[model samples]
Target: MKSELEKREILLESGTNEVEIIEFYLGGQSFGINVHKLREIVPYEPEAMTSLPESGPSMKGMLLLRGKTVPLVDLGSHLRKRQVENSVERKVVLVCEFNREVNSFLVDGVNQIHRISWKDVKPLDDFFTPYKPRFTGCITVDGREVMIVDLEHVITEIFPEQTIFGEGEVEGAEEADAFKRGSRQEVKILVAEDSNIIRNQIVSILKSSGYEQVTSFVNGEECWNGLNMLKAEAAHKGQDLREYADLLISDIEMPSMDGLTLCKKIKTDPVMKELTVIMFSSLINEQLAHKCQEVGADGHISKPQIHALVKMLDEYCLK
Candidate 1:
């Protein structure tokens, strides 16, 4: 195992807006995930898996490692491709941790890591919006197109209750909803999110909570531009951004700009710095949270925590 100091050294400094992706192969196609999402690659041991009775097909089984129960997911099966099954392949398991959970993904082989800027990652077109495409984005690494797996969506598929801004209320949500119906909240919010489904859900939640002034952008770049537009409009009219928007909620990963860059830009601004900035994503962890803090995020919240999110709203927006 790599020592703690060695692990921290491997991590890039905050607000660089770059990612180290560990590329791997499954069914002869290239796929990758953020290195921060990865824990370690382990040799596959078929005899160690304990099968689950009612689990879905893509779920291979569970493995007990170092006093932790880690689920194993078959990358090929999940992607619905089986090109490697009949061939002579040496499988390896990529143990990964994200959103405060760990799982092992079975893949055909591994490749070298690639360091690239987040701006280079291209978002998929809107045609994929109707279907739940399990990819964050794709990047061309040395002329090879590598699809970055959306492991958050993969886990959500396996556990439907944990959707981003997802399913049934989180206990106090009912009371919060009741309170929302009884009052009017004039909070103006700006949101930047990449996923269409998740984006809509957030808008829906905010509207349901009596927040009428909400503006959303597909990615951080667009959000930044929107803020600039507000700035320009305010400058020309001698108004203030305070009259337009009060806060910003941004997701970490996006096509043209990532959340760290957005937060850093917002904090360093003279006038816009006063706006409260909250960073939210499905990939929030201690390491990423520390990075968010370094970039001057006022608060960091993970996805699907309706109750907690509402409480945060109460603290900053409602109180």
Candidate 2:
């Protein structure tokens, strides 16, 4: 029987159900945030705020919501170099629990919700050299282009002094118990990530989930080559290609060919099209999720709650 996680993966890749969405406008473009992170859309009243000193040019000010003060960041200023000029249409978008923190974004205006397919979005390359805050991915809504904001990236950038890496240790003895009890028959996961630390963290998490076999690659090109090689080997050995790789997990931004290109290659190739693929990215956006769907990805996940990842895997891969 397919695991629950595998079932969800199957449902996602096969184009089965409805997904949540949030619509907004920026730089004359209309975009949407995943309903997962969207908390609520509130009217922006300039009078209901307190400014934080030394919070940089983009940090507009703070709002006292129900007695607690929350910082409201200017989304346009951070991502597209556009400012949230004083206007009646602008509103504060409350993004729930990014990096485990409650945050709000200031936008030019709020648009209606878009019932977009998981397959219609794509991630935009950070052609912006050093990259900017709030930039995650982009998609088209009602014939207008909109950028999906990376709430996690934005929160991390704003609070650089705080360390979000909790009790960081990899494949340590502490996880052995979980590995023994929860793991299925060892499954192989092909992981492609650019950063060594992040890669190691992902590896450790997968291992803890009972995925005994994992092949880690630094970039999408290598991952593609590796998968092809594995496929060839499996054919030679008369083994099933599905047995070699239970899933493919990757990061979007990499050195050579990005994750989107890799996903496109894998999905287009008949030899590997059935392989379950999930994109695990720090860059959160509906546009990237849409692109993943376009190229035939199984699903998309944010690196917000690392622990929640295990639950995701269990729900999608191990049932």
RMSD to the hidden true structure, all candidates: 2.6, 8.8
lDDT of 1: 0.80
Would you list the clashing residue pairs of candidate 1?
A: none
Q: Which pairs of residues collide in candidate 2?
A: 3-319, 4-319, 5-315, 5-316, 5-317, 6-316, 6-317, 121-290, 121-291, 122-291
lDDT by residue (1-319, candidate 2, tens digit) is: 1143223333433222234346776666565665546545667778878888878876888877778778888777776545435543455555454443567788777655554543455556658435533444566765666666556666667676533345543333245475543554466678998656568867876666566687899777789889989999999999989878978888765545567678888888888988888888755565446767787887887764555555555556664
lDDT of 1 at 158: 84
Per-prediction TM-score to the true structure, in the order listed: 0.90, 0.56
- How many residue pairs in model 1 have overlapping backbones? 0
